[model samples]
Target: MTTTPAVRILAIGGSTRPQSSSELALNVAAMAAQAAGAEVISITGRALMFPIYDTETTHRDPLALDFVEKVRTAHGILIASPGYHGGISGMMKNALDYIEDLREHDPSYLDGRSVGCISVAYGWQATVSTLHQLRQVVHALRGWPTPLGGTVNASVTKFDADGSCQDTGAAEQLAIIGRQVVEFAQMRQASTDATAPSANSGS
Candidate 1:
């Protein structure tokens, strides 16, 4: 019997401060994706530090290049952001900007991938707004946003340093997103496989 490769998931987000609530939430979602049988690669916290995206510069930073490569190869993605003043944090936005490097890739910027979005904020307003923004960005990138995006109010749902969630309800939402991403990617892959001409068919 032949074995199929595990789905690759690129998990990115989190604040500059290590182990922040946003990162913890991302971890929860990533873990859930893993449980759903995906291989997750996470780029968070300080690892996300990159120069502000400059469309004029042809030169790419080494770290940014590696990030782009990961994005290029990922079959699915999870993006979590901390809502800052009713928007995504500058750092997180900057990292996302790096996706521009993938414009010429076969599928282009996040195209045909399932993206799971999570937004963490101190209040419902920021959480909802940030989640909406994430979905919009994903759409612009040509990625499909999972139906169940997570909106985590940092003031209400707290996380332990070990990446455990205090609120069961919020935790379930995060897990659901992760699972949805993997499931959608699998379905997309199946569809593609079905549509492709069979190797045995004449050219």
Candidate 2:
């Protein structure tokens, strides 16, 4: 009997400030992914600190390399970005640019991976626009965007330092995003395994 390996779901993004609401939101989503039985990898705070992406240069800082490797092997992804100027924060966007490194991988740039996107901002406009931009980026990466994306309005909602979300609706929505990513990843993995050749098959 062969048991499938646990799905790896990489969660990335958050504001540069430590323990910001955006980061807390990301944590909530990751927790849900864990509860759903996927192993979660987080790239937040200083872990997301890297030099600007340069397509002309092959040289990459250690942080950039690490981010690329995680994305390369992840079965699913969750990204929670702080909304800046009605779009994603520069820090988060820079980290996302590193995904170009996966273009040479066997599956190529997030292909067949499910991505859950979240946007935390002070206003509805920023949150909604940021979420829209994130979904567009997921499509561009060849990843499937979960049916439900989380748009958290910080003006009306708050995440406590103790990792508790003040808004029940927001918390539930974020969890749904996480669960959906895991579910999609599981389905895709099962499909791939079913089509794989048996070890005992003769050439």
Candidate 3:
């Protein structure tokens, strides 16, 4: 009997600051995706620090190239961002801009992939707005946004040093988002595989 390969879920986000709440929240979600049987790859903190995205640059930064490669192969994605001025932080936005490199890929820009999004901010206003913005970005990229997106109000909720969320409800919701992404990715993969021509069948 053969087992199915684990789906690859890439988690990316967070600001420049160390151990940020947004990063911690992303970790929590990534953990949940792992629990749901995905092979999770997290690109956070210093890994996110790359030259700002420019469409006309002849020389591409190594780190930027690495980031693009990960996105190209990931079956799904989970993004967590800190709210800045009622939207996503500049760092997170810049990282996402690197995805433009995939424009020439076969499926292009996250097409046929599930994206789980979360936004962390001091208040509900920023959290909601940032989450909405994230979903909009996912839609523009042609990715499927999970049914449940998370809005974490950091003013009242807290995350532990070990990347665990302190608010039970918030934690559960984030986990649900992660699981949903993994589930959708698996379904999509299975569908694609089923539709492909068999090796033994001659074209």
Report backbone clashes per prediction: 0, 0, 0
Candidate 3 residue-wise lDDT at 187: 99
Worst 10 residues of 3 by lDDT: 55-64
For candidate 3, write residues 1-203 as lDDT tens digits: 55789999999988778779888889889999999999999999778888888878857888888888999999999999999999998888888988888998999999999999999999999999999999999999999999999999999999888778779999999999999999999999899989989777988
lDDT of each: 0.93, 0.92, 0.93
User: TM-scores across all candidates?
Assistant: 0.96, 0.98, 0.97
- The sequence of per-residue lDDT tens digits that candidate 1 reaches over residues 1-203 is 54567899999999977668999999999999999999999999888889899999889889899999999999999999999999989988888889988898899999999999999999999999999999999998999999999999989998987789979999999999999999998887788878989777986
- The deviation in Å at residue 23 for candidate 3 is 0.4
- Span of ten consecutive residues with least summed lDDT in model 2: 13-22
- Which tens-of-lDDT digit does each residue in 1-203 have in candidate 2? 77889999999988878678888998899999999999999989778979999999999999899889999989999999999999999988888888988888889998999999999999999999999999999999999999999999988988887989979999999999999999999999999988989778874
The per-prediction CA RMSD against the true structure, in angstroms, equals 1.2, 0.9, 1.0
Q: List the residue pairs that clash in candidate 3.
A: none
lDDT of 1: 0.93
What ranges in model 2 sit over 4 Å off? none
Sequence-dependent TM-score of model 1: 0.96
